[model samples]
Target: MTEPADAKAVRAAETAVAAEAPDGAGASIRAEHLVQRFGSGRGAVLAVDDVSFELDREPARIVSLVGQSGSGKSTIARQVLGLQRPTSGAVTYGGKDVLRLNRKQRSEFRRNVQPVFQDPYAIFNPFYRVDRVFWTAVRKLTDLPNKRAADEAIRDSLRAVKLQPESVLGRYPHQLSGGQRQRIMLARIHLLRPQFVIADEPTSMLDAQTRRGFLDILQDFRVRYGITTLFITHDLSSVHYLGGDIMVINKGRIVEQGAVAEVMAAPSHDYTRLLLASVPAPDPDQRWTERIDIGQIR
Candidate 1:
């Protein structure tokens, strides 16, 4: 089914707002002096040191948090998605202080700002149908009854993510390929129809070719659905393809922030430059292992 003209226009208007820079009022996501540390004993480590940025949010703007393994890219995502709270800092979303909200207070914000995790493979359970995720979504967002509305919602979500529901509904997680499973996660976002999506390394597990293809899918979603996105990745190469505005993080701090092309062309900080230099050039003789294991995250 096609999106309605009014909906499309609303999305377009939202897109316009998101595309605005920091000078305007469209900063949908803002983090101020954000600090996140893990463990309080002898082994305490800083996950996100002092990250800060104002991202224009609506539908069209695509912001990337690029950094190294310990740069706290995913950590920032968690704080924004409300999966984790900052040890000391403030995250204001649409004029609401995220930390101030109780479970019931934050429900609407939670629905508006959903998350797409890194491991697409682990998104679903093998014992349940793919719709189980949607079941949880329905329970949280709407009061849909019976199989019919639920199934239709699932199918529509699948369509938004460019997957055929008939091919995927009853299938187990193991039945689909890596990229397909990731798209299914995207489908869940479509059902939720969030204003913003915090995608924490959503395509990180895929091969280089698949990863590149998945970028288009995400961009299309941002454009078509008018969903603002926080695309977080440790790799800098992805910035060129996905980032409209860039936030370079290192040792838990935001070292740089600006337009994607400008940041790529002339990165101000040495750390950001080092990151830009690290993007694997498309060399014919180069082999792609695409493995950057940073140990098991808790």
Candidate 2:
């Protein structure tokens, strides 16, 4: 189905925002001393407190922000995505502060920076065909001039995500499993070919087999497309699987951060050690209740 002309024009305007910048030129994303607070007085809460980090373009790295619930990881992701303004500090792409960008620059930012949200079901409309999600993204985010070309692009992306277009094209969201829906999300992102991706628990909903498959595709993108990713999740196992830098956040503060190997091998901070110790082991004797010290929880 073709998109309405008005909707198509809006999409064109959004993608055109970054037309001046050569595609893929903006490689790095940096969060500088960001602080996001809500409410005031006693009711006020600091969600992300003075968190700063950078995702470098060189090596096309995956940066994992690991934290328990309420650690403010999602808040930081939102700040980076330009969905929410920080109370202080800034998120910059290629050295330009995202929140401070003009309309055109903001549009460019949108085109280059894409997000794969935590809930695949929440991202799609139940009423539309699953393929509609892919085609709609093509209509708005890309400039493939004709139907034939667009179909080829869609087919390639679906294959990349391990979804056969013939099987998934005419189906609705409910007709697909959680894993298939997540793959669709990845396929949509593949079509956009964004420089940086904000992946908020992208694999959290899938089963073991499907989870690994989804993550493999993501790793492939990092290696092949040179896409830098801000991977946010509560799973330390996933962090280890992705094999990148790890930043451990606790109660809105960064408890520890460094290369995944370095942090895992010798966690200097109390919270980091606590997180590592909390990981469940296959040995029945290695119970978390016994290994974890209650005193170090701060």
Predicted model with the maximum lDDT = 2
- In model 1, the Cα lDDT at residue 145 comes to 64
Per-candidate TM-scores read 0.80, 0.87
Cα RMSD, each candidate:
8.8, 5.7
Off by over 4 Å in 1: 1-27, 102-104, 143-149, 280-298
- Clashing residue pairs in candidate 2 (N, C-alpha, C atoms within 3 angstroms): none
Model 2: residue 58 alpha-carbon error in angstroms: 1.2
Model 1: residue 84 alpha-carbon error in angstroms: 2.3
Global local distance difference test of model 2: 0.77
TM-score of 2: 0.87
Writing each residue's lDDT as its tens digit, candidate 2 over 185-290 gives 8898898888888887777666666876877888899999988888988877777767889998998999899999899889999888888887666344443223
Consecutive 10-residue window with the lowest summed lDDT within model 2: 1-10
- Compared with the true structure, the alpha-carbon lDDT of candidate 1 equals 0.69
